[model samples]
Target: MTVSNNSLDVAVLEWCKLMADRNDKHHWSHVVTDAAAFEGSLLTAIGMTKDEFAGYETAMRRYRDKFIAHLDSDAEMDIPQLEQAERAVAFYHSHVVEQEAEGIDLHGLPATGAQMATYYHAEERSAAIRYDAAMQPVAG
Candidate 1:
């Protein structure tokens, strides 16, 4: 079975939400805590058991580290902080795109007022991009 990038991203977002649950505190506690919960769920989501999922976690950790390094090299901010910020941005963008594209209205979505506001902001910006692109002159 083929898993799309969107699915992976959605899974990551869900995992992040799980980590950020009121009882979990994975965000303020540590990255490993989030990763551990994410790894297990993601592996199972893609079809794998705990033992078989360990390799996937290792690979994901390596990829995340590389991404952090690249972001650090490109920006002045701390790598870990940048990575976390970027992940949140990416997750928010993905959810907004998914919901809007599916003709789903997100007004007053439950459990996340700030997040929904951010989604609306992103959707407005994205809509402007689409309008601008449509208005642009095309070369023959």
Candidate 2:
């Protein structure tokens, strides 16, 4: 892997290299457990199953390969679902990073970023309703 003089080439090549599945020890499988990707283990963490993950990965690959990396004949392309990716990352963080790597405390964060997002969204809706009820017009 020789270093390229062009900045853009460096960035693109780095991504391509990372995405390639040489299946060596550096591969993601070395860290991500089947149970973490599929089901609950002793950690009791939950995430997308292998099939579900594959679907998301396929969508992303199409987007990356056809949409971003290069242009194809297709006028439209399927987008990767970010929420799905987020859950997978969250699972990986808890399953591998926190468990395997030492001294990384994520104590303040929610189990999933989605949980915090949904919680705040719901809170906004609830607050609006409460405010509306309190500010209701009184008829004498």
Q: Against the true structure, what is each candidate's TM-score?
A: 0.28, 0.46
Model 2 has an lDDT value of 0.51
Model 1, C-alpha of 38: deviation from truth (Å): 11
Model 2 residue 7 distance off true place after TM-score fit, in angstroms: 18
Name the lDDT of candidate 1: 0.45
| Model 2 residue 20 distance off true place after TM-score fit, in angstroms | 9.0
Best by lDDT: 2
Q: What is the C-alpha lDDT of each candidate?
A: 0.45, 0.51
Task: Please give, for residues 1-140, the per-residue lDDT of candidate 1 as tens digits.
Answer: 12233434444444444433324544422333355554454444445566644444444444344443243353333212223333443443443444323334544353253565677679768866876777788989
